[model samples]
Target: MRATVIRAPHDIRVEEVADAVVREPADAVVRVLRACICGSDLWAYRGESARQPGQRIGHEFLGVVEGTGADVTGFAPGDLVVAPFVWSDGTCEYCAEGLQTSCPRGGFWGSAGSDGGQGEAVRVPFADGTLVKLPADAASDDRLLTGLLALSDVLGTGHHAAVGAGVAPGSTVAVVGDGAVGLCGVLAARRLGADRIIALGRHTARTDIARLFGATDVVAARGEEAVAAVREMTGGHGAQAVIEAVGTEQSMRTAVGIARDGGAIGYVGVPHGSGTGLDLSVMFDRNIALRGGVAPVRAYIPELLPDVLDGTIDPSPVFDLAVPLGGVPGGYKAMDERTALKVLVTP
Candidate 1:
């Protein structure tokens, strides 16, 4: 068996590794049919953070069940499933409350778990709780791989932002970035009935997709300028809802500044591990409710799964490159260089 490993920053390698086996009664092993490079993966790749050498390096994936524990009743051998980035016990208090990302005992795949997501077959604990069953047909079909793979992360995260932001029909919304997640946010907003979608993006191609995903407008601005533009678009009233997709100081500021005084700001960026200098005085003055962070992906996956199956949402457009697992290094380079909005890896 082989897996993608990042031994160090900018040091990704594909090496043959030991095969995975079930370690618990709730565990299962998945033969990955498809996996993807996530935006958070880039944080470790570009030296922003440290990734254990050879740590399994992927989390968003879809696969066929190769084996399952005796107690697992919801899945079987050869069943296709979507594995959320975080594995959780669905019965946990948090999971029960629709916040699986915060499950007390949940383990994130690309971090403290057995390994990363970029591999041929991987050990998956809590199989019944973590993997979402997809239509049997999609398991063997490569065409459905792209969209099916998205249920694990970006698409789910995007849906989280929209739901959290309360995007209403005929409402004006502002999306704070143009990355895959940001574009997906635009798509999610449209699905929620937001009418005027303003995407703040500088890249022509990314912004174009934002429009395709349902953004009614685009702005090539940054920092305060971008916030100003979003306000101007709303006739100085600011957007009724704002999706902060970029986890940066500037992105957060822009999201806060461009939202209507009483509007909600739903953010799902990875926080880039930076402190936000939020002005409490202003936030209080505006009566704005600012909330958003790590999306409880598992909570949204089930809801968004049908849309992808019925062809109602084409989230796959975010993939600018799809590479084999062995070429995982290129996935890092492509995203780091801004050559790709999102990269998908086939294992």
Candidate 2:
């Protein structure tokens, strides 16, 4: 089998690797049909995240089950399923409370000896708890396939940001950044019944998609100007909720600045940049509630899967380009250069 590996920052390669096989009774092997490059993956690509020289990479994927361990019963060979970026035992207390990302027995893909998602096949630990089976009649259309792929990470992460920000019916919501996750935040906000959605991004192409996903307005401004624009849009009160998708000091400041005094911020971006301090005084003075972390994608998949399958909300547009498994290095480059919104990898 061939898989993607990062030998160094900006150095991505697809090379032959050992075949995936069931190693635990709770595991399953999946023949990856589709995979994607995530913004978070760029952290390592840019040499920001710590990783070994020859580490396997990627974590968003869906595929057909090729085999399962004796203890796995929720699925069987030939079943189509989506693997959450993180694997967890569904029986854990945290999983019971919808916090699977924090499950004691849970771990992320491509970590702790798990095969990365961008590969021919991967060994899925806690298979029954981590894989979501698709309907037998799942659409073969590329759009539907792309949308299903989003459920594994971007869409679910966006939903988590919105929910954490306390977005509600009739609420005014603002999203920072225009990445795939940011655009998905716009979609998630609309689905949650937000009356107005303000999207902040400098790229016209991305902002256009944000609008299509339900952004009521696009602010191409930056820094204080961006903050002022969102504030003005909310009649000087700022947004009731703000979703910070960029995970940078500047993006976080923008999110906090554009949220009303009693509003909340849902930050999903993997925080990067120089070690920046959070202004507790400002948050305290404004009574702002800040919440977010690695999204528990498994918890949100069931809620968003129906929407994707029924075509009620298609997030497929995020994948502006698709390449074969062997072309994964270019896919990573395209994302790093911002030449592509998100790259889908077909294995």
Which one is best on TM-score? Answer: 2
User: Which residues of candidate 2, in runs, are more than 4 Å off?
Assistant: none
lDDT of 2 by residue, 144-262 (tens): 87789999899999999999999999999999989999999999999999999999999999999999999989999998999999888888999989999998899888888899999
Error of 1 at 300 (Å): 1.4
Please report how far candidate 1 places residue 98 from its true position, in Å. Answer: 1.3
Predicted structure with the largest lDDT when compared to the true one = 2
Q: Against the unseen true structure, what C-alpha lDDT does each candidate score?
A: 0.86, 0.91
Scored by Cα lDDT, where does model 2 land?
0.91
| Per-residue lDDT of candidate 1, residues 1-347 (tens digit) | 98888888888888988888888999889998888888888888887977777777888888889999998988999898899889988888998988888888788886844767898988888888888899898766666678888888999888888877889888888999899999999999999899899999999999999988999999998988887887888889998788988888878888888889888888888787567745667778997777777888888887888888888998988988989987788888989999988988887
RMSD of 2: 1.0
